[model samples]
Target: MSDALEKAEQAAREAATDTAAVQIALAALELAKAAQQQPAPQHHQCDHQHKPRRSAGEWIGIACAVCVGGAGIAFASLALAILGGTAAIVVLVLRSMWTDVQKRR
Candidate 1:
């Protein structure tokens, strides 16, 4: 009778342990499913607002004005100053356009 009682108690302990393990596994599985169903967090751009870049023509006009002003101040002859200023403006415009084209590629 003592031997039979000991065997029964040992079996009960093993059954309790197995039941606890199964319950833990089920809880972990439920947590995993919930995590999977949740949507991932979305990231946004920095504080700076998105602004359109200056058009090529606008950039050219601005560059030309600056160049002409600087050339007029530096040169003695108006004709020579104007010519140099125009050349500088053309170069700036061409360079700007080239860069824009390269960026598109």
Candidate 2:
């Protein structure tokens, strides 16, 4: 009789442990489902895309670059003009020399 009573007590303890495990599994499943659900969006916020604002230092850097580029273009134009003037002067001197040679002939 005592052996039978001990076996019954062990069965009851095992049942209690299984019940607790089942409850924990159900709770974990509920938590997982809740985590998978997405939150609702608020209606008050605007969805328009925005450009990032430039800093003052960045604007100053851009201005400096533009000024330098313009100065470089101006110098290039001046160099071309000097080259053209030199070529014209050479042509005029060569024409005068040809005329002098023709008179000697």
Candidate 3:
């Protein structure tokens, strides 16, 4: 009975070791196959489409500059008109004052 028991124990240990080795080999094979199946990485390419890049921010800045320049011109013209009107009023007041003083003399 002892001999039978020892033989059974040895057989189970051998089977377990064999199973472990088979699983290791299968895992290594699957890893190798996966590495082979992967596609190679391509180099970064600069195409014609990527060369002429104009972002929306740049366009917005250009438009803003144009609008501000137009506004500045309009404001300057308005300021000039106001100055001219003030000057005309001053000249008229001075002429009337001088004429009245001459008539009283």
State each model's C-alpha RMSD to the native: 21.4, 11.6, 8.2
Local error of candidate 2 at residue 40 (angstroms)? 16
TM-score of 3: 0.45
TM-score quality measure for candidate 1: 0.44
Question: Residue by residue across 1-69, what tens digits does model 3's lDDT show?
Answer: 999999999999999999999999999999999999999898989675756677999999999999999
60, model 2: CA deviation in Å?
0.7
In the range 1-105, model 2's lDDT, one tens digit per residue, is 999999999999999999999999999999999877967665787689788999999999999999999999999999999999999999999999999999999
Q: Rank the candidates by lDDT, best first.
A: 3, 2, 1
Error of 1 at 38 (Å): 0.8
Per-model tally of clashing residue pairs: 0, 0, 0
Clashing pairs in 2: none
Give the best candidate by TM-score: 2
Q: lDDT by residue for model 1 over 2-94, one digit each (tens)? A: 999999999999999999999999999999999999999989759988799999999999999999989886775777878999999999999
The runs of at least 3 residues in candidate 2 whose Cα sits more than 4 Å from the true structure, single-residue gaps closed, are 1-48
Q: Would you give me the overall lDDT of model 1?
A: 0.95
* Segments in model 1 whose C-alpha atoms lie over 4 Å from true places: 45-105
Better of 2 and 3 by TM-score: 2
Candidate 1 weakest ten by summed lDDT: 72-81
